[model samples]
Target chain A: MTSILASAEELTGGVCCGASVAVPREASGCAMEAVRALVRRRVRDLTLIAVPQAGFQADLLIGAGCVRQVEAAAVTLGEHGSAPRFRAAVSAGTVEIRDSTCPAIHAGLQAAEKGVPFMPMRGILGSDLALHRDDWHTIENPYGENDPILLLPAITPDVSLFHAPRADREGNVWVGVNRELLTMAHASRETLVTVEAISDESLTSDVRLAAGTIPSLYVSAIAEAPRGAAPVGLPGYYDEDTSHLRRYAELAQTEEGFDRYLAEQVIAAPAPA
Target chain B: MSEAYRPEELLMSVVAGLLEGARHVAVGAISPIPAGGALLARERAAGRMRVSILGSERHTFFTDGGRELFDCAAQGRIDAFFLDGAQIDGSANINLVGIGSYPRSRVRFAGSFGSAYLYFLVPRVILVAHEHSRRTLVDRVDFVSAPGTSPPGVYRPGGPVALVTDRCVFGFDRAAGRFSLSSAHPGQSVGAIRDKTGFEFTLDDAVATTAVPGAAALALLRGSVREALQEAYPEFAEHVLGQAA
Candidate 1:
């Protein structure tokens, strides 16, 4: 049930299921392209939860003319009808990015990492900001103080696509201390590792990486893409594109505008908008 | 006597009017003046006033013994805000996008981080500006970073309780949310504020700027802010002058 490769063979097949899996080593150069290929092929669905970062940088997606629509469930905007002039959207034209930080997936990953059922959080208890989102809210606590803390059901992505710094033949990978990355990697059904460089030795060979934020067992396919977070982040070497950030911030100002952005950036356009 | 005031004097004076009665306020991401003013208010007012600085970056090292102020808004603790606008029209529609037409505009500002979100929710929002020019005081913002109006009864509706600028002070008509000139800084003419804005204003009789900082208040502001910033960001002392303790 795995599409991992022995050489440059890319894991291009859709999600697979199995008790044990073996993915391609990072020596393969098709990791990022495979994830992008999946998106280009329109494979992943809403049920597939993405992480805090890693995957398409939302801003770049907006500028690329791929967004399609926006669905805003847990955000601050339009109490009555359509969203106002400013507010993140539910479905941008090409893809849909949740309005705020995905504390749910993060918390869930944390819980998963800690081997727990749920994580409690504050701030969503009193408001009906995101209506159909019971998956993120828990109104029960005997003490009932932080009652509305999100349960953050474990993320368990259909596939976890992440860019790392390096990897070895056995699929051991190394990356910067990407805050929520381990959460996404651990909680996903499958893990796709995209590294910046491939080391001849197993990643476990590096003492720094041995501390184990992302244990090797969690990854499936490890491909090398040199600069996966390019134009967005390159940890230690460069900073994110600030102007790109400003542009995304500008587009995310309104529901309609954000939707237009999704269409323009994420979607392959029924025809590129 | 008021006629002798210069621009910077008018600025401090105008700021006083905007902050006159506020007890709790919020300042959100990416604004330097509003962020700085909210800090100034808390320092100057002490425990009598509470100001929450919300930077979208959600991290802070303060200027006055203050904890890093980040993620306060996400937690829903903010009460009021000091909002800034790039292009403010008569109705106070703020435009941060750019000047003129979309593709061919003059100045394009970083759009709102969450002004609209906070505007609708925060009990009071005070629009602060250092640049009170016609270009800035427009009739409407090129874009509505946040709306000035809110619905009745809902907690997050209604907007912009007050608008403060270097030229004058404005308050909204509770019902209309339109900006009304409540007071003018020393030497500022109603005509001047009106000329700067795109809409006509509900002007009140001339009022002098808030009195100059008393010797004690001035010394306290300088000392406390300096101490706070220094302690809050021990490393930035060189950048902040001797403000660090």
Candidate 2:
């Protein structure tokens, strides 16, 4: 049965230590609240699979020492600059980095979504990204002679987490135009989402909203956390809190500063109502 | 000609010039200059060109998700794309995955985004690196996040066409696997660019000076283009273009 929780902390209970967690790319629609909850829980040895890319959320997890590994195309703060904690972690050899490209990450998830062992993809032929990843195999095309292609093994994450605009009581999430969230949900064993509000009416009742809705069947849990994707923004709902993010970028530069940020913003903060 | 322009505006003009004939152009994340250039090109093309700037609600048309961009590029729908690197070699090799050996590094950069895939699929890839020096333009990249050139039988239709930096523009020849000094930016000499660059490149005797944006171009940039760009890059529009978002 799908778990409908009232708080972000409760929604994060489904996540287990050492589990592989898949996250979306864009700064917007990221499960920042749930990430904080997870950080507070001190979930350890996590394998973070960024759908294609990552931003502040990945950095926070790495900073909190929750992630053991990161598999993504990139982890940056975007305009704010490089993700400080992520950079520090990589520099200190504290976290294992499994480098991947954008399309390859998507293809791997698509493979999982289709229940395939692997998916064939173009490019990455001459890249060191291909060279380093032993699991990514290169095989000659069976139909076309002498044509070699790279094959990525399915990336079936244990959990997929993100934020959205809203969800119905039935757990149907309205992710709108961020369709990669759908791919993440379909590919993972469990999809945990935090939304701005819990709609009493069914999202699928309307034809327009239904087109972008993720059916309740795919969602394992839902939490109502208003302004949940703060600092990152939630597309139409709000703009990015750049000042806050810029402050994070500066504070997260050092270990001591990061710890203080956790203490003030995360640990001491009141729990979601 | 008398009007002054910021360095970013100058770079934007150069990028716009490179994207002249492209039907569809995609700008990746955190690339305000390329985004500006694409917007400017779209304005000049009279809506014939499609500009997709990632992270913008107004600019992008992709509803199928992040993978759609890569899919579109592979199908040859995208004509031009922009890429940046922490280190770019003479051969056009780009390194986004930090300096030093693989897995471990002295200076770890933001890992390669989609360069490995898009660099091969997009026909015209413009390499943009604002910091043009020996440190950035290395003799050989420590890590080839996306190789500039591929061996035979490697199906590659797209690779770097040119590299634009603060100093000058270097036109890439895929057939020769080399870069030739195409043009020097205003007030920059060929000798000065050579001194700053670490990688080797052929310099033609008649290297032209990069044309600065004219009054009309500047007007469009500071007006409509800057306004359009604000949605995605408010800081860039405000500080770089000197406009309030």
Candidate 3:
């Protein structure tokens, strides 16, 4: 089955480009709203990953009962956060929370961006962290000659949703100086963007500098909406949403706690007018 | 006699001004100038200045790396905190996530650790960074790591009454929700400060530089860090505590 046992190269797109992506209801819709709509449709099997720094609203997915998994490489406990007592995986449909100082999983997507079989990384060695490998495997570095590195099988999400500082209606994106966003957009086959403002004018108006974080070609759809990363700053617009920070800090720490938080703060909360 | 003035000196000097009298404080990572300065002040001010090192992950420790700092602060003991943002916008919001695109971008620097959560409640916060530019200082941030001014009476991580940058020292104008130029260091100018920010600031005619680390305070810190570290890591003390001077 091409869908079931496809080679690493064939599957996945955006951020983790080796998996299937769920097309949006419309090619162009508000990025976050589209993500919300996607969650509403696949509430049972989905994993959400985004930096909490901008308060990207992971809580919303958790609330819809869609976030079956959380993924971050360098995970920390809450004064006493331990690994989840329950074990979950891609097949099992559980969220794997990965929090590392450097973006490893994101780099996995970058490896996919280059269409490579694996991405080499630093860290994750000399620690017991490599112990939990029921699925993930380590390889003897072919390039480094005997040095071993971990290969996170590239991840292509069902949908890669992002919020940018600015984007064009045709799905062309302008990310200013922050370019790793390119790796993110490239890592997914289908990418969705919610922007601070949309300019029908070519982004190279010369008034604003054009540093490509994501090219229009990579983006599947683009929606212009202000404060899309609201409560989090809009790049050049506003700062984080304090209420969200305060509420999330006080409430979400674990899977269940964070899930409950999403329902009340994001899903049930009134949409911005 | 007054001491000779410079940027590195002023960086440490600001910490002296902010922590000379505070009983307890937290210092974040990357820039260690103020942190090193504050610890020095406590030693000289009759050893009355009790400061703790609080890193981004909410990891609190002493100069010797003991976890006690975290324990004490968690128990509601820390009084002042210093932090930095990835992106500092118009409202003084911070974004430290990877630069470029999202989910898959070129460089994923470091993720935000508790700064957002910490700033919300810490009584005193001091925002610090070496440079403020059109990129660093912005009208708004792509991500909100920590905010200079928060909603009124809204449990704002207290004590962040001042912002110390390489060019100038600043504080928030509660009514305007923007940073006001407090003082430029002895030699620096406001124009120099404005040049580095990604966003604009309200600058007044008089700006002040940070106060220098007086002899007495430096001497106090010099002696204290050594004596304490001598028992734990003697070799490290010789390097970090400045062996001869």
Candidate 4:
């Protein structure tokens, strides 16, 4: 049965229709529509990997009980305020938190992309974050005496998920200046993307766009969801729905408020058929 | 008599002074004061200084997402940056992760972000915290997001240069691995700073009063920088600078 499923065309259809996956930042380019769909579908116990920082997406997932653990630099609502759901989860000891720094997460993902065991970074020597993370270890530089550095293990997520401006017919995505999305796709076992539009021409056809494009070989799935990163901005295309985000920030301050928000904004909305 | 300025505005002026010679300065998430300061510095430099503010399309130049900022810092492209913590000790160690033991226990902040890495990479790191009390300035940080100083053999180009608060300013001496009383803000005395600060530090003979932002600097802040800040930090611009988000 698995042998019959070996075609490239079938891969996108299979991968894009899944439940749990890693996602990009909620404040910026994320698969918000897919995240909404996942919430509506009642996906549970999913582990999400965020890009350095996240915002409403993390809060919403936590409020909906869709996440089991999260790995990221920070989960903040930015100018809006504290991420109410994340703060509540931490205080309640409900969710498993793997607190990480921005570069350490990025280094870890880069290591995974290169199939390296670990990547060494500078400046975390005295940080409590270094002390807490068992996977991160201190090692003396072979070249320099008495110099110690922090080495972080690779982070290969189960799925790389995001919202992009466009994907060509061949499935290659043009992410523009958001290149970390490329690294996420490269390091993850599977890539699921929601695009604002499907380009009529192949992304690789233009040499200029080709440099910014992620080849379909790394993308396991692609879904056409216009304004897929809504409420958060997509680079080069849209701005964050600031009022909506502020409203979420305000209403999500309490558990009841969060649940009410989830019920109305996410759960109550029907998944696209 | 000259018009008085807000405590935050005074702090921003001091921060701008610190950022004066920096060619490239980057401001991370939730840092409106530092962002404003950087913008002020840029304005002072007549747009000569490059300010890359995170979450702003107009300000930042990174095309490769968050990692690009870190990568650029590693290559010595960025000269200045800002970091704040839930707790900061005398040695300049920052704690952004939480209050208690890791994987469990107490309060948690929005994680470390890139402090650990950037603290080593960027040349000038200005530590900013609005509250100057014992809770914020601790004897020892529960967690170290980034150590102020590292061993000699380790390659480090960046660390805390100074700390600006509502009450005063403290200059970090890397050699002494301690903070020295630089100056106190208007209406704030050295004794008041001593009472507020949790960590012990060396004091100068006479603490100078923090320089107030002149009419020109104040004008630029309220006019251009405040308006520019609205793009990335709407609430901060509106609430802190009296501009609408």
Candidate number achieving the greatest lDDT relative to the actual structure: 2
Q: Per-residue lDDT of B127-232 in model 3, one digit per residue for the tens?
A: 7866656767677765444455644433333435667776677776655877878877666666766666666667656654556656655454457644543432
Per-residue C-alpha lDDT of model 3 across residues A168-237, encoded as one tens digit per residue: 5445677664444566667676666666677666675554545554667777666555555554444345
TM-score of the second chain in each model? 0.71, 0.97, 0.75, 0.96
Report lDDT (Cα) of residue A169, candidate 4. Answer: 76
Give the lDDT of residue A157 in candidate 1. 47
Q: Docking category for candidate 3?
A: incorrect
Residue-pair clashes per candidate: 56, 0, 91, 4
* Cα-based lDDT for every prediction: 0.47, 0.91, 0.50, 0.81
- The DockQ values of the predictions, listed in order, are 0.06, 0.82, 0.03, 0.66
Model 3 misplacement above 4 A: A1-42, A51-56, A74-101, A134-137, A143-146, A204-208, A251-270, B1-245
- C-alpha displacement of B222 in model 2, angstroms? 1.6
**What CAPRI-style quality would you assign to candidate 2?**
high
Which scores greater on lDDT, model 1 or model 4? 4
For residue A193, model 4's alpha carbon misses the true position, in angstroms, by: 0.5
Q: Which CAPRI tier for candidate 1?
A: incorrect
Error of 2 at B123 (Å): 0.3
